[model samples]
Target: MKKESKVFGIYPVIEALKANKTLDKLYVQKDIQNPKIQSIINDAETLSITINEVPIEKLNRLTKGNHQGIVAIISPISFPPFEDTVETILATKETPLFVVLDQISDVRNFGAILRTAECTGVDAVIIQKKGGAPVSGDTVKTSAGAIFNIPICKVDHIKDAIFYLQGSGITTVAATEKSGSYLYDLDLKKPLALIMGSEGRGISKSVLSIVDKSASIPLLGTINSLNVSVACGTFLYEVIRQRNH
Candidate 1:
């Protein structure tokens, strides 16, 4: 996927916002008291573009040209709202297979998981908006362009996603080492959303409480855990196997 475009300059940035550009984020000079800056801030607030105030040096570092204390980063891929993703998938009349990553901060792992998910025909991959990897150039390269092909939904909270999936009649299976149920034993031939947690902390306790089923991979060796991406792939393929059979 292409990198998000960065637009700088006060008038141009404001025009881009006025033209309804999908901005990834906006950066403004801190402590600017100009009326034009205040107008831009007001417009940004109305448009819901995330605004960050930083020093003039930071803006200078971003570009040597006249920035006029404003820069807007345009999103490359249009992120579909979570509700629209869910509704569209449900409208398809096919079994929905979603993968939700909880606090998975590693970019490579996130990309690898996306690659595997695309290969396995997953309907969508959901991630938290704040804690997860930002969909960037590295992620696109690592995902082998699967990031562009697959539908990725960003949510405010994984718990909210869990509840939404459950309400929509999709069974949520959390992949964790804490559970005794083997991946092989679970019934995976159903509309399901699989949750994969972080590498170090595992699934958050709050998320774990809401999952419909929790299963773990069997370890035959001394190592107690597998890499998050590897475990994600294993769990995904198991679902594929069950569904295919």
Candidate 2:
């Protein structure tokens, strides 16, 4: 019932954009004709923010006050500068590990993954600015405060982060059943990044294309897939196991 994470009205939304606020998404009134709305649309598109055009009723429900047909959801946590985070981790840690989340949208799964990453000694988490789960209060609760313990880097695209990691001599591996290899077969002791995709779609083809390797968790039962966060824990602990030996 808290609207603290939202900014309503045209002027406030516009100012939020201008201030470079960490925005998760934008909602505009459908078929509304206004020059300001068009300008906000253009700015949101340029920033790669997810935009939804909803009916006036939906906008009204989001806010009791006049919304002027716009509502912007503010992210709960600030994302660190991607390159600076990566560089600092590389400099400070020997055999640093990273978890690159490719659009993991479920808040519970995302929070659980953060907890696993922190427990498994992952140096940082990389996520896309638009497609991934919004860092909300539920995320904080589910993470059990681990969200504050780990550094998160948000990039424009998942593939770009993978490319940067590879350039920095970090091996990039993706978790997907489409791969022929198993997780146990990989040498994870080196500085590396593990990429996990969304719950329904798994990894996108474009992202999977650039990863240095791909591995799958063995499924012995009829179920072919594991929950994204559960799968992520399995993967991270494997890396920890390999490194410990």
Candidate 3:
């Protein structure tokens, strides 16, 4: 993490939020009750940022100095609005590719997927503002600096993003084991968006119904499923393969 990226203590964080700074995430000490801190929580929620109430020791480990109960991690990159980004990409690329992440909060997995998304030339990555992984140091490092290169779009909800994409003449594809159709069966040559979920609860039932195609990565072994990042990489490369041929 860069030295100037984080603000320690409650007042600093609260002021940062009031100033409308782009905050990636916020961590507060569990069970601490103060009116000012409550204000911070309200502001963070209003901005749709992910918040965690961790042990005080966790906050202490984040910095050598005193934390005063709250710490705000500033994002190095600013995310574009989901609607504007979609409109811009649709205007340019003939067969634009977008990646939609559903409740995938693991920073490492999110970072790795960003790397693959960048490699595959994805126009932008769409993630839910609240439950998705925060743009933190760990995520940035795991992405191998791809976070800086790729356009990240923050949306109010994953469903809204999907609906908007489909409305704009983009096909939405979901990767989940519940589907019988293999990834190769899907036609990705057209403008499309790929939706990937967390390892815990694949894709939401509502989201599954909205996707244009439900695809699965064929697994030969006994393993039930593949890691989210690995599955995303496999599907992205398959799109490349189909477009080239």
Candidate 4:
């Protein structure tokens, strides 16, 4: 998908809906009570497109041009529901390996991480509806089309997702510098959901409180931290290594 193909305006998105175009996701301004907007929302819901309520600033940043408080991401591939993806993983009888991204806003970083996750056989990629990278054309390009292959779930809150995963018997692990245990020490052979946070801010405090195990990659160099995408690769491969053994 190219940059121009990603539609980000209220009218454009509504038109897409009217035309029955396949959309990856849709972002609507929070607290919008307008009847017309509600009609659009209703139409989108009828089509079963993933819709999220976000702040107006997020919509502006997605497109500097007039977005009219709405943005729709058109994707070549349709996204699956979070529950369905989880169920599919379990049905296949494979250890559920999922990735939860906390507020990772950069498109390139998001795409790169998706590429790594796809290569590592991750079942699904979970991200918050707000404060995360918009699934734009650049992200698709950066992932080298891996985004189409991988199932990405946009949730209302990461904490809620963690709770759901825990309820489903999946162990949740947070990869952060604050962790005392090293990544290599964790047993990743079981059903697992690996959480990676944003570049500027680490994992959110609420999310950190819920993770079952917290582990970190041992840094050998003087650098205090690793790039978010690189760190994701390391953590994912560690899971692969452990599962193989």
Candidate 5:
């Protein structure tokens, strides 16, 4: 497992948040109660930080000293704002292609998608700040340094990103097995952003509700669904194929 940049102890974590640090995720012991913990929770919620409730044993395993029932991981890279990134993309490209990752927690999977996005001429890769994988050294290594080459936008919620893209006239398409629609049915040559969810659970219901379209890949074998990275490659190449034809 990749080691994360973290801050343990209650007061240190609170000070980090007060300094407006960019945190990847926050882990709090389940059922932890204290004035400081309450303050931390309020700050995290206000900042739209992702919080995970873990057992006390898990907290003990993470650190030897006093963790004070809380830990926060600081992200290595600075995430760009969605609106600015979109504006920049529109200024240069007539029809831009972007990718959004929702609940894809594996750093390797996230890195692979980013690599594909870079190769396929994708304008950007958007992710939900809380649920998505943290961008770290492991991610950069897996991507073969492609993560640095690509632009990433981290938003508070996946659904919000979908709505923002739509408002900008960028067509949104989500990959889900539940949808009766086929990937080839829609024309993807226009300005668009593709939403890909994790294999365990496809796009969240709230996100699916807002997407312009939902599509599924054709499967011939016994496997129920395709790995997200593979499916993402197929989607991007299809866009390229349509534009070339």
Candidate 6:
């Protein structure tokens, strides 16, 4: 198992938040009552940081010292601002390609997607800050260090990122079996951002509603579904094929 970097106690977490530190998640002791803790929770919520009301034993296992009913897991990697990453990629790449993940909670799947994104020349990978998997040690290892090479953007909402991409002349496409069109039929040579949804649920309905188009990979087999990471590679390779041909 990979050891996670942690910040325990109340004031330290507050200062970390104030300094704009990239935290994977904040774990607070369940049933604790304190005004300062409430303030911390509010601040964390505003920043879209994931919070878990865990037992004190969980906090104790995370660290040895007195936790003061709070502990924060620091992200192994920093996330670039979403708007800044988009603007930079748009300015630099002629036909920028991006990957937008909607609530991919599995660390291994997220890492696999990142590896594929880097391999397929994706401009950036965008994920929501709270609902998605943290950029932790497992993610880094699973990605084979591709996380360091590719720029990852953390956004407040997937829909916001899609709207921004659309406004910037990037066509947003969702990969879902619910779609009537096949992935091969799309013109993906242009600037594009491919959206991959979570494991249990495919793309969210609101996100599917706003995308430029929705595409599905053909499934001749009886499975009728694919692993999110495998499906992501299928989508990315199709984009590569379209662009190369």
* lDDT tens digits by residue: candidate 5, 123-194: 899988776777776787778777777888888778888888999999999988888988999899889999
- List model 6 lDDT by residue over 128-217, tens digit each: 877778788889888988898999988888999899999999999999999999999889999999999999988899999999999999
Clashes of each: 0, 0, 0, 0, 0, 0
lDDT score, candidate 3, position 145: 89
Candidate 5 Cα deviation (angstroms), residue 7: 1.5
Compare candidates 5 and 6 on TM-score and give the better one. Answer: 6
Candidate 5 — which pairs collide? Answer: none
Worst 10 residues of 1 by lDDT: 129-138
Check candidate 6 and list the clashing pairs. Answer: none
Residue-level lDDT tens digits of model 2 in 140-188:
8888888888999888888888999999999999999989999999999
Give the C-alpha miss distance for residue 144 in model 2, angstroms.
Answer: 1.8
Give candidate 1 misplaced runs (Cα > 4 Å).
7-16, 25-73
Q: Which TM-score value belongs to model 2? A: 0.89
Off by over 4 Å in 5: 1-4
The Cα local distance difference test for each model comes to: 0.87, 0.89, 0.89, 0.86, 0.86, 0.91
After superposing all C-alphas onto the true structure, candidate 3 shows an RMSD in angstroms of: 1.9
Residue 114's lDDT within candidate 1 is 95
Per-residue lDDT of candidate 4, residues 1-245 (tens digit): 44425677667877888787777678889998778778888988777666889999898888788877788887655556788778877889558899999999898999999999999999899987666877777888889989888899877789998999999899999989999999988889999999999999989888999999999989889988999999999999988888887
Top lDDT prediction, candidate number: 6
RMSD of each: 3.3, 2.5, 1.9, 3.9, 2.6, 2.4
In angstroms, the error of model 5 at 151 is 2.7
TM-scores for every predicted model: 0.80, 0.89, 0.93, 0.80, 0.87, 0.90
